[model samples]
Target chain A: MEAGKRINVVTKILAANDRVADENRRRFAELGLKVVNLISSPGAGKTALLEATIGRIRKDRRVGVIVGDIATTKDAERIAKHDVPVVQITTESFGGSCHLEASTIRQALDEIPLKELDLLFVENVGNLVCPAEFDLGEQAKVSMLSVTEGEDKPLKYPLAFQVANLVILSKVDLVPHLRVDMEALRANVRQMNPKVRTLELSSQTGEGFDAWIEWLKKP
Target chain B: MHEASIAQNVIESVLRLIADGTVQGKVARVYLKVGKLTAVVPDNLQFMFGVLAEEGPLAGVKLEIEEVPIRVRCKACEEAFEMHEEIRLICPKCGSADTRFETGRELLIDAVEVD
Candidate 1:
């Protein structure tokens, strides 16, 4: 007989990931809880944005956070200062996994009292690359890029920008000092993601935060 | 960093297939069709699979990853060719940015062979 070859297995992998992601999304929908997956490069102010947003919204909405980091509970520690339920998933526990998997998120969900919360924010590990590829069962995925990070970031890392429903331009307070062209950044973002809502705000001064809060409040 | 997590997804899927009578034990190889535009690092995925599978049901299964390059067809000239990264959308033949991407965003388990 001619040499018999083995069948390929890539389809099985993606199908399984999609099925689990769908299951997780369905569960979130059932709870009527809007889960937001927050992604960005390190120091893009993901934690700061979370703190500010949580401080603004937590008064009316029950907010919970699952923070992912490579090491230390630094981000989780900062988020815990806001007095909301927080869980930290270190990469070390999962053999240095950069993004939270559906199974991991499912376990984290078990830790949270879903009925008691209106929104669950998963602050994904601060890397623009790997986190964008995996879906964490979120109702919306928000990519945080700082003004200091430059405008070309979205064009360079197109996948992250393309997958996000919203792109928050964090640390706008530094815009005056930095040379970031806000208009060009917005244009590039619009080119990559036409429908992605862009918000420019400073977590420190609280500028443009109201619109962000209102955006999150909308159904 | 998330490569291992993605590999875990692959392993989980293969196991489910086995449980559902899709495949048998002792998988020889797993083939993946990954697109360049998908941003998945194939080496990281293979490394992840190797590490995770050492203790799982997919133990000893070989990983085969193939890259699928993006191709675009120009709206103006109807020219189809492989996309060059330096020039994202402009058609090389006609130098028009009005083109629709044909491929390069697939992430799928094409097939698996098991004992």
Candidate 2:
């Protein structure tokens, strides 16, 4: 049968990773925990936003965080200040993956006291392109886009905006210091993903944080 | 960047098919349909596929990637359109940001040719 079998198979390239993602989803669903895969480009303020969000919302909601990185444990250390159960997954062993796969999330889920938390924030490694392609079994995909990046970022990285459930425009307090067009950024995001909700936030000054705090509390 | 890993995944998938010992000869070509919105550069992915698919059932196998353009349906006017330019997604007719995408996020292998 090895001469000319010519069998046809239609398969998705990411099927293995996606299988683990679905498993992670079911696992979270069983534990009654909501998972949010937070993605962004480097220096998009994902860590600071998580720090601020966890600091504010952890009082009312039990939150757990899993930080994914290529080589550093620094972000996990930053989030540890909130006195929450934080797990760090470093991809250095696995060829330093640019994005977090569901298997890594599963491993991290095993490390954390998942049942004790209401929400689990899986902070994906900072990359606009790759992270948006993988579903880490999160209930929602959030991207923190810093105003310093540029107004044309949404147009350049449309997949990130397109897949995001919420695109937080971080570092907006610095808009005055820069020539960034905030209106154009928001409009581009709205045009890219009309279903995505957006917010402007500055983790430094805590401006426009109340809405995010409230958003976290909603069922 | 991730295309190399993605290309490896594609090869792994094809190798799994021939592992059953049904494939007749050396795999000639693997036909793939990748969406423009998936962020996969066809040339880059094909390059990686070439490097990784060596020394196996997939050795010298050509990767044929069919790029699909982004198609959307305007939520306001209910009109469908294909967008080729990388710009703000707006309905040419109704100018609505609230448009639903019909296609352009696929990354799948549709068929394989085995000699």
Highest TM-score model number? 2
Worst 10 residues of 1 chain A by lDDT: A1-10
What is the Cα-based lDDT of residue A169 in candidate 2? Answer: 94
Q: Write down the TM-score for model 2.
A: 0.92
The weakest ten consecutive residues by lDDT in model 1 chain B span: B83-92
Backbone clashes in candidate 1 total 12
| Highest-scoring model, DockQ | 2
Model 2 lDDT per residue over A1-219, tens place: 545334567688899889999999898889888888888998899889999888788778899999999998999999998899999999887678888887888888878998899998999999999999888888989887999999888988889998888889999899999999888988888778876889899999999999888877766
The two-chain DockQ for each candidate, comma-separated, is 0.45, 0.55
Worst 10 residues of 2 chain A by lDDT: A1-10
- The residue ranges of model 1 lying beyond 4 angstroms of the native Cα positions read A8-12, B24-26, B54-61, B72-82, B86-102
- Write candidate 1's Cα lDDT for B5-110 as tens digits: 6787788777777787777656788888877777778998999899889977777888889899877677899988885462145566886656666777777788
Q: How close is candidate 1 to the true structure, as a TM-score?
A: 0.86
lDDT of 1 at B19: 84
